[model samples]
Target chain A: MTQPIRVLLAKVGLDGHDRGVKVVARTLRDAGMDVIYSGLHRTPEEVVTAAIQEDVDVLGVSLLSGVQLTVFPKIFQLLASKGADDMIVVAGGVMPDEDVVEIKRMGVREVLLQDTPPDEIVQTLTRLVAERGER
Target chain B: MSRYVPSSELVERAARGEVPAIGRLISRAEAGMPEARGALATIYRRAGRAHVIGLTGVPGSGKSTLVAALTARLRTQGLKVGIVAVDPSSPYSGGAILGDRIRMSDLVNDPGVYIRSMATRGAMGGLARATLDAVDILDLGGFDTIIIETVGVGQDEVEIAKASHTTVVVSAPGLGDEIQAIKAGMLEIADIHVVSKCDRSDANRTLVDIKQMLTLGAATSAKPEWQTPVVGVSSYTGEGFDALTRAIDRHRDVAFGTASGSRRQLAIARFRLEKTAENLLIERFAKAAVTRAPALAERLRRRDADPYSLANELLAASFERGSAHERDHHRPPHFAEDHW
Candidate 1:
């Protein structure tokens, strides 16, 4: 049987704005991916632990609180420390282009901005998993 | 990352309490990957030491929050806890949003607690098919208590009772009096009933209603070895958790310590055997249908054959091919004979 691509969407730090994240969650779910939402105000440690435990193919951190630069690095550090650096990490929500480039440099596989269309979001995630190939 | 690691090595790492190894094995098992079968059998043999608890209830009943609270309570006693929380998959997309971990954020960083969220993946009865397998993997990983928090369900999803040594059914206030009365199917299967959100005044009514129903059930039936207790708790205030844990512990004692406990075990084994066989047979049937059903469907559409006979033919062909395939592959040692 073909396993569904599992993605964990986490709202890290003090971000209470989850409307966009919930929309992305629905988009991912409707596009045939198992989405585990870690809810809001999750610590970087909590997110990485959840990502590893869920054995997700992707970890999508939605941050509208503008802590992407600070949080994504810490998340990647935790993931590396836990020997789960192989997991594909993605970032979403409001961020400037320079921070996006820096976040990508920090080892995030993709940085999805707030305005990325639903279909594009779905296609991008699906292609990322496909490019990574099967487990 | 796609490189194959032998299952033996994975199992060895899992036995040493490696979280990543256990998680990987569980993922393999959940996906129904054939390579994990021997490893799973080994894990199964090494399991049964952990106390398996099932917590299930209706939607909006606070099952997930209660699980977080209960896991916290269990952890205070220095017990290692493993949690399998299940959520439903959409019928259209075959995907799910497993939001149980949202309520369980505090437990995430604790090394003593391991939580895995599962999608129902088209399985019925409010549980994923691999839930018990995950439980076994966690059991072999040295968890002292394994808790399965099922997808929020209504009356008919009593499969948790068959899979667990202790089943706790959570009920919340304001769902209506008639709704509780109509849930006799669920009420009968509870080893312990919890009225969550007890900070609300209406929780007292729910508690009383459940207690009254249990008393009525006890009077009509032969006295059970364990009397089901209805305890009110509030995740917000943390009221009555100690009493709740005590009741759960008491129920576990009766389930494992008494002669009737052995009977319960036999029943659980029988249920598992039947359910596993049914799943295997369905899987085989689906596999066979992929290759053979189109022609059969054409014949049926043309009125050349009926469904029953064609279905029987399909089953026969599938099993015949299965046995031949089994003959070609080296068979693993039977569970009873394997000493490892």
Candidate 2:
């Protein structure tokens, strides 16, 4: 039986605005992955646990509260400690170009800036997640 | 490691009001087993005690903030509250997206309030089946009111409203257009309509739009005689929590009624048993289907047999299992009846 690719979309830290996140959620749902959104204000641990239980292939976090430095590192470390390093972690939100580049070095697959179109993020993620399945 | 499964043990402890043990017990019970079933039965009796209030709105409608305020007001009234915050399940990651901590900051330190965020788990209509189960767990844990905060808009809100005594639909000003779009649609599910972020100038227009929709809908749709009350409040400024709480309180008692709430208890009991039975049957069906379908499908695909004959064989097999279940399940009762 063929299962739809599963993506865990989360909003982390003090940023509680979920308009962009929900729109992305609708977009992803239309794109045909079994999208599970953690909704708003998720911490790294909860996101990791949900990924494990939901058996997701990619963990995507969209943060707009300017707390990327605190959240991204924590998610990466938690995933590693939980032996979830194999699961791809993607970050998006209001990060500077330099911060996005720096996050990529720290084990995040992509840094999605707010300037990035919703479809662009979806397409990038769809390609990355689809590749993970091929392996 | 002995595969140290404490779930069974934890479930037993939780039923007895050992507060610390409830979470682990709920996890194990959700996993489902004989022990979990027994634990659920004992704990489920305490369920119908709470009034179920459903809070739902659009994305960015500030639902979480509103609920946090509702929790505060309920606490002041010396009421124990159970909140089941429904989160969307992601397609790629297949997990809960909204984190538990940040959404419900106020309740983190409060022992009186228990907040559990649930992913729809790929289920349509927003709230998951497990959400009902978790509500019972908290009800048994002893809450006076249980609030279900839904993840998104549309049909899911209506479904949850059917389950709750009072369904509070939250929305804001700028969302006036979208709220109007769904007015004759899903927003009609509300027992009370709340317009949050009332401080904004547009809030009044949004409230007026909702009222007009309500008025138009009331003519055609014979809703309960009481108009679905509309209130404007800003969760940020701590406004209107009191009225929302009062309305929630009054609506619950009247809807649940004079049997001293025996009917709601029966409803929840029915909900629990129905769910438990469905869960068991589904598990059995899946296991059997997984093991046997490939060969059946392969033969069908090869055109060695027609679909009609294939279905007949499958039906016969299912009938055999049905008879076996009836025989085993009814034998003890049959013998007792015969003896009588």
Output the number of the DockQ-best candidate.
Answer: 1
Error of 1 at A129 (Å): 2.3
Q: What TM-score does model 2 score on chain A? A: 0.90
Poorly placed runs, candidate 1 (over 4 Å): B1-4, B220-223, B322-340
Runs in model 2 with CA error above 4 Å? Answer: A1-135, B1-12, B15-17, B219-225, B258-277, B299-340
**Ten-residue stretch with the least lDDT total in model 2 chain B:** B331-340
Tens-digit lDDT string for candidate 1 (B1-340): 2455677788988888888788888898888776788899889888888889999999889999999999999999999999999999999999899989889888987999999999999999978999999999999999999999999897789899999999999888998865565358788888888999999988888888888888777876542688888899999999989999999888788889988777888888898899887787677567668778898989999989899999888877566634443343223234221221
Question: lDDT per residue, candidate 1, A20-118, as tens digits?
Answer: 999999999998889999888888988889988888989999988888889988888888787776788998999888999999999888888878999
lDDT of 1: 0.86
Tell me the interface RMSD of every candidate, in Å: 1.7, 8.7
Tens-place lDDT per residue, model 2, B1-340, is 0123344465555556544455445444444434456566556654566688888888778888888888889899899887777777665655444444355665655667766656675555657757776777777767778889887776445557656777788877886456656675665677788999988888899889888777777777644445678888898887777888778877776667745245544664575566556655454444445555677788899998998987666544433433443333222121222221
lDDT for model 2, please. Answer: 0.67
The best candidate by TM-score is: 1
